[model samples]
Target: MEKYINAFTDSLLNTLDYTWRAMTFDVPWYTNFFWGLTAISLLVWLLEIAFPWRKDQSIFRKDFWLDTFYMYFNFFIFAIVISGVYEILGVLFNDLGITAKSFAIIDIASWPMWAQLLVFFIIIDFVQWFTHVLLHRYEFLWQFHKVHHSVKEMGFAAHLRYHWMENIFYKPLKTFGVMILGGFEPEQAYVVHFIAISIGHLNHSNIKITWGPLKYIFNNPVMHLYHHVKALPDGHRHGINFGISLSLWDYIFKTNYVPEDSGTIELGFPGDEEFPKTFWSQITYGFVKPKKKQPSN
Candidate 1:
């Protein structure tokens, strides 16, 4: 009996030790990423209920569990996938007669930490903006990006919903852009993404606040929802409002839209079509070739 009791006690202590490490460890970006997301999401959820765009929408809306799965999968597994791809590309660059050392970006660490942070934020946001535009302009890329827009009932977790292979299309350009400007330590980049993605969660969320004039500078729910609008607004036929965190890019490029009644529109693809409802299917969706249109007789 004592031996059995001791075994159980050891297991309990081991469990506690693991939990404490998870809560305390900061090496892997996901530890801080997960905790930061959790805390911000809780506050966002509370505000969502108190100042909701759609009062009828529940916290436990459709695909809630699936979105949670996406949040973890993208944050942990796919983040590692991105890192691996970045490394492989570095190897490829070396093979192509360009050595890794030759491509090294300036270590901008000599600048004030806050200045480095600001530069990274602006550059990363621009990279995101450019990558997002490409995803929409080409149907092949849209196959991956469309999974994100497939949500009928949007919420905080909706930001996390994405096709797994998106990094393949997005990361090379972004990494190159960052490298050209100045390569940051992993920690600096993480802080920038943490803010950028947090804003994304809030925009996708059901919370409806205009943020007054700040709407022109930063993306808000009204502007982002219009981005998800099935049809084009006013001028262009292809989708508009592709900005990630900053709306300035969209404004300068003439893709910005602010429908007077953003609350009334249905979000998702044209004709309100469906996407793969399952996580695995969504990840595999980009692999399926789109049908070519027949030539007119």
Candidate 2:
């Protein structure tokens, strides 16, 4: 009977290992990328149609196409460039023996495929929430990050309108650090990457999900929208949700805020309202001049 039980366990382990290997590489980046972009874009447009953040329909005009182009450009071109840099940095760290030794507490890879994904999502989100809060509170880093907040509208494309410097300094570093510390295999890290990018697009989307209690679990569109609010005088804009996947960290750290009476609080930097609408202007302005100081109460 003991021999039979051992055989059953061995077979299950083999099956799980095979399944994880298959699923990890089975990810068709082209198909997933197109579908993810299409789905998120459609949701954003639908929200605009339904809620109409601004009565002036012109807000979503030809200029929107320009902004959309810049968005996709950054997502594909700039993303690739920064990721290449990250790979180089990872290699350097490995050579210097700076990474954590293999000591993962849970071997989720031996579990069911879905379980592995859940673990990855939860862990990555926890790391991101803390890193995000640090970036906001630290004045030096906020200079580069403020560009993201300069967006006057919250749409799906708004997610990609980040300075490449911010991505270089944050996502790659934090992700690489977590992978090294967790001793996650390359395949496991890949799955986390796909999931993170997909959810990031979703979080910045215009889709209206009530989320209810689930808001505590997943960082939904509404929660993220608050994070985009430009700083104000009476108090900081009632937008502080910073977690990309889960809101647990934000809640734990006292950074989560959702006002019951607020509705589409004015989005964009304090002085960005007068900035040129051109893409070049936005990019240059973000880096050239120092960020306008937040008004003191």
Candidate 3:
């Protein structure tokens, strides 16, 4: 309960920081991220255009524009939803008289900015890796996550092409984790997110760049591509290669699966099931559950 309260306090602080910064200076931390995302997307898209990992992959490929729409929609919807959540959490915490200034889990303030950033990032990434695995293994959660894997061809934009619920679930939890572990101010969050998103785009990108020895350190194109592969490794009920930015987590857990190649298997899940093709169907997919089966004699 103390940890949760701590997390809530930081959430409140972060929102106020956003509000104050934007109103006073007209540059919220999130706005910095929005522009950073656009620049990174453009750079990656240009690379994809010139030297695509799959040279056969086309710029006008199916759902290409759809992903762009998803990217833009994600920023808008995320800001709105986060603001609403922050307001509710803020009121509650204020009522309790808990605040970021009142408490902190650790004294990272004395640490160098880069060191503080790195430590907090690893902690959050671990939490995210765990959440991602849950989405793959759990039946109800998989319905939302299926939207992400539905993309037949992975691209940089595919990073944000997730069921909106996925964002709802991830963003709050990550913010909470960062808070309880060690409070993150808006400036700190902005720096870490830029690095995380840049790698995420590359991971989903159609680029053939190799990380070489860094493959063991950071999650790269090859490792992440295997994650989206249809087949799970033997004895694995859920998918493998669950790490995002860092390959180390999957390595420590033994969930990382990088074969000679991902093989020539189809993308998305391998089963009788096929996720919805259009945007609307994908968003509302959670409502359409499978019927219960009759008991056997």
> 63-164 in candidate 1: lDDT tens per residue?
888887898778666664455345555656666776523545666667887777887787778888998898888888887888888888888888878887
Q: Which portions of model 3 miss their true places by more than 4 Å?
A: 1-31, 93-105, 262-264, 271-273, 289-297
Pick the winner on lDDT between candidates 1 and 2. Answer: 1
Tell me the tens digit of each residue's lDDT in model 3 across 151-193. Answer: 7788899988888888767876776666665555544767778
Which lDDT value does model 1 have at 267?
79
> Distance from true position, residue 141, model 3, in Å?
0.9
* Counted clashes in each candidate structure: 0, 1, 0
Full-model lDDT, candidate 1: 0.74
With a 3 Å backbone cut-off (N, CA, C), the pairs that clash in candidate 2 are 226-239
- C-alpha lDDT (0 to 100) for residue 264 of candidate 1: 68
lDDT of 3 at 81: 43
What C-alpha RMSD separates each model from the true structure? 9.0, 11.1, 5.9
lDDT of 2 by residue, 1-297 (tens): 454455445555554454344446554654345445555576667766776544454446434576577666665556544444455555666667766444345555466666766676676677667667766777776765666777765665666676566665667545654454365544545566656665676676555664788888778777777787665434444337888777787788777777742335777666666555666655565457645559899
TM-score of each model, in listed order: 0.81, 0.71, 0.82
